[model samples]
Target: AQRVTQPEKLLSVFKGAPVELKCNYSYSGSPELFWYVQYSRQRLQLLLRHISRESIKGFTADLNKGETSFHLKKPFAQEEDSAMYYCALSRSPGGSYIPTFGRGTSLIVHP
Candidate 1:
């Protein structure tokens, strides 16, 4: 079974400060990792995926298979960046991949 953990339930930081949202996973087989964010009164959206190797909104996450981690990082955080972030893990059991999400971490960027 695959599991994703985002140890912190809430992460608070000031504007213009660096931000790092931790995400760790445990899976026996090859796993796919993704970061999703939901703003107030908005639907959840894909922030980034390990496979994409691309940064979104100045945030980037690299898959470290050795550590079984895919932590999201941003050089500097903005007030508008505050949102509910979720870490997800997916693996093919036989057919399609079913994703398991973390409890979620609320990021608060203070000005």
Candidate 2:
């Protein structure tokens, strides 16, 4: 069975601190890993993808096949980036990446 695990339900910290959102998954075949973020009152947008090897808004994620994890990391967290984050995965076909979102980790940035 394919499953996505996000250990933290909520993460809060002051601005300019480093942040790491952990994610682990279980899949038999090749999986497409993605990180989707949603700010307050904003639509969810793709933050990064393992396949793309791209980082957005100071966030980057890497897929570890051995550990079966795709954790998101950022050197510094900004107040503007504080939002709800979800780690997602898709099947090999890549036609319909119906993401199974984790419970979500709400990041609160205090001034």
Candidate 3:
């Protein structure tokens, strides 16, 4: 079974401070990892994918296969960056898509 885990339920940071959200997963097959974010009263949106190697809204995450982790990071925090973040894993070796998601981490940025 594939499982995704986010250790922190809530994270608080001051403006201009750095932020890191932890994520880990357990799977037997090759996994596709992604970070999703939802702003206040907004729908969940895809922040970035490990395969893309891209940064979104100043946040970036690299998949550490050795550690079975994908931690999101931002050099500087902003009030606007406050949101709920979720880590997801999905990959169907046999072509059936089954996605597992973490509980989510609520990020609060204080000005």
Residue 12, model 3: lDDT of 99
Q: Which ten residues in a row have the lowest lDDT in candidate 2?
A: 94-103
Query: Ranking by TM-score, best first?
Result: 3, 1, 2
TM agreement with the true structure for every prediction: 0.96, 0.92, 0.96
Q: What would the per-residue lDDT of candidate 2 be over residues 9-96, giving only the tens digit for each residue? A: 9999888888999999998889988999999999999999899999888899889999999999898888897899999888778456
Q: What C-alpha lDDT values do all the predictions have? A: 0.94, 0.89, 0.95
Looking at model 3, residue 1 earns an lDDT score of 85
- Residue 101 in model 3: shift from native, Å? 0.6
Give model 2 RMSD, 1 decimal.
1.5
Against the true structure, candidate 2 has what lDDT? 0.89
TM-score of 3: 0.96
- Residue 87 in candidate 1, Cα distance off native in Å: 0.6
Question: How much does each candidate deviate from the true structure in C-alpha RMSD?
Answer: 1.2, 1.5, 0.9
Candidate 1 has a TM-score of 0.96
Evaluated against the true structure, the overall lDDT of model 3 is 0.95
Q: After superposition, how far is residue 76 of candidate 1 from its true place, in Å?
A: 0.4
